[model samples]
Target: MKLFGSYTSPFVRHCRIALLEGQAQGTLECEFIETDIVSSGKLSPTKKVPFLTDTLYDEKNKAEEVELTDSASILMYIREQSGLTFFSSANDYNLFCNVNTVLDAAVNLFFLELKDNILPTEGSYLERHSERVLSALQYFNQQEYPTQAPFSDGELRLACFLDWGLFRKRINIDGLDNLQALLKAARSYDIFAQTAPPEGA
Candidate 1:
């Protein structure tokens, strides 16, 4: 199996963490290929990072290769294939949705700031995006989240998104104690420490 994506992307990082955790449990093994989005255009219909290609063996010993495009889909596929429990319950699934909201808003703001040269403070559209980012963070911070060794997909993605948003200066997380504590706890895991986004990103 092979995974493709940039090191700085939280979406990609979440998948990497899942694979890492799976491997730690002796359930998964694969290679990660760091590919630039522009250069990876030919790799998938979405032309995005975190693309996956897996070779599967059938009952008859026939080899079949499968491709996955979306990060969520890729993660789900990894969990199913490896029998690794990525989500512990419906609440975990709900938390994943909440964290995903933050990621989506932050990503839009990130691209708007970087690619379109639009700052959040400069327009209502961008400002709304910032509002969504803060709302999600504030709500998540207040929740009594469960602690999972190797981190649940929601926990992993939340910490990665917070770090990335902070690094990019896309959102301000003032007085978010729970969120801060979550990040600190997540770092205790080697997967998060090793898969952290590059410095100066």
Candidate 2:
């Protein structure tokens, strides 16, 4: 199996973290391929990072290769291959969706800010993107988690999004207690540390 993406992308970081955990569990064996997604079309139809190609053995013992393009699909395939469904319930799935929404907003704002050469101002699509990011963070702040909740895919994606947002200067997460706590907790894991985005990437 091989995963293609850049180091700075939060979506890619999420998959890298999964690969670490899955490897520790003895269920994953993948090679990481860092490349320019915008210029790389041979692997991804979207021309984006977080693409995965897996060679699975079929019931007839034949090698069959499959490709997964989006981060969500790639993560789902990882869970399936590792036999580790990190989402425990519908609530987990909802949280995963919420985090992905924030990720989308952050990416959009990042691009628009670069294109316009200014921070997202009021009454603009970029401003709306900023609003969505903050609202999602605030909502996540109020989320209740069981004490000592084991790290799961939802948490993994959330941590990656928050950290990447801060790293890229996409949004502010001030005073979001729950999110801060979760981020701190996630960083304690060796897998999270191992998958940290490259400096200046």
Candidate 3:
């Protein structure tokens, strides 16, 4: 399997953690392809990073084909293909969805700030985005996950998103206590430590 995306993207980092965990569990073998999303013309369809390709086999003909595009779709495809449905359980699935929503909001805020070189003129709407991000962080800070396992898909994704957000200095979120604990737990893992996003990414 091939996973394509940039190192700095929180979305891509989420997928990368999943891939690494899957590999450690012997569920899948993943090849990481770091692509330049801004310059890459191949990801035009989805216009995003973390595309995937897997070979599907036919029962009778014994043929193979490639599948591609979109991080969520690709992740689902990989989970199904590898029979690693732990992440797709109905209970965990809901958590994944909720956490991903928070991640999306945070990423949106980051990009909006980036749009004007991190300087917002008075009366700019960027404050609204910042408000949303802080609200989400506050929400997360008050809740506890069902498990503290390092490899739980929801936990992994959440951890990756939080750290990547911090690395970019997009939002301080310093008061989010639960989030800070989760990040500390994530950092304790050697895999995550080694896979930290590149400097200035």
Candidate 4:
């Protein structure tokens, strides 16, 4: 199996963390192909990083290749391939999706500002997304964080998103105490460090 993404993608980071944490590293024979948005455009319909491809053999020994176009789908494929579950409970899965929601909003806003020189203009779609980002952060501040190693998917995803948002200067997550604590704990682990984006990103 192969995973393609950039060094700085939070979505990709979560998948990496899940593989390491689940001890699926050697089992999957996984290869990570570093890619950027421009390159991804030709490889995926979404033109996004973190797509995956794998070769499989059917009962008839027919070889087939498959492509997963998004991180969430890739994650589920990883889980199935690894025989591991990232979510400990339904609530955890819900939390993971919520983090995706806010992170997506922030990323969209960041790109709008970057490529279009647009801000969250009053009553606009971007404006509503801005509100969603702020509201999600405020509520997530009070969430129950993962306390130790082998953190759940939601916990790892949240930490990656927070760090990315900070790195991109897209949002300030300071004062989100619970989330901050989770990030601090995750940072102590070598897997997290190993998956970190390169310096100056």
Please give the lDDT score at residue 21 for candidate 3: 62
Off by over 4 Å in 1: 146-148
Selected candidate, larger lDDT, 3 vs 4: 4
Predicted candidate 2: what Cα RMSD to the true structure?
2.0
Q: Model 1, 1-201: lDDT tens per residue?
A: 999999999889889888876776675779889899686798878877889999999999999988999898999988887777757888778888888876887887778777988888998877887888877888888865444355678777788888787777776667888887787787777788898888975
Please identify which of the two predictions, 2 or 3, would achieve the higher lDDT against the true structure.
2
TM-score of each: 0.91, 0.90, 0.82, 0.91
- Candidate 4 local lDDT, 4-86, one digit each (tens): 99889999998877667556445666888999778999999989878999999999999999899888898888887788875
lDDT of each: 0.81, 0.80, 0.70, 0.83
For 137-192, candidate 3 gives per-residue lDDT tens digits of 78667777532455567677777778887898766766677788888877878777
Candidate 4 has what TM-score? 0.91
Error of 3 at 74 (Å): 2.2
> Which consecutive 10 residues in model 1 have the weakest lDDT in total?
143-152
lDDT for model 1 = 0.81
Off by over 4 Å in 3: 39-41, 86-91, 115-125, 146-148
**Among all candidates shown, the one with the greatest lDDT:** 4
Q: Compared to the true structure, candidate 3 yields what TM-score? A: 0.82
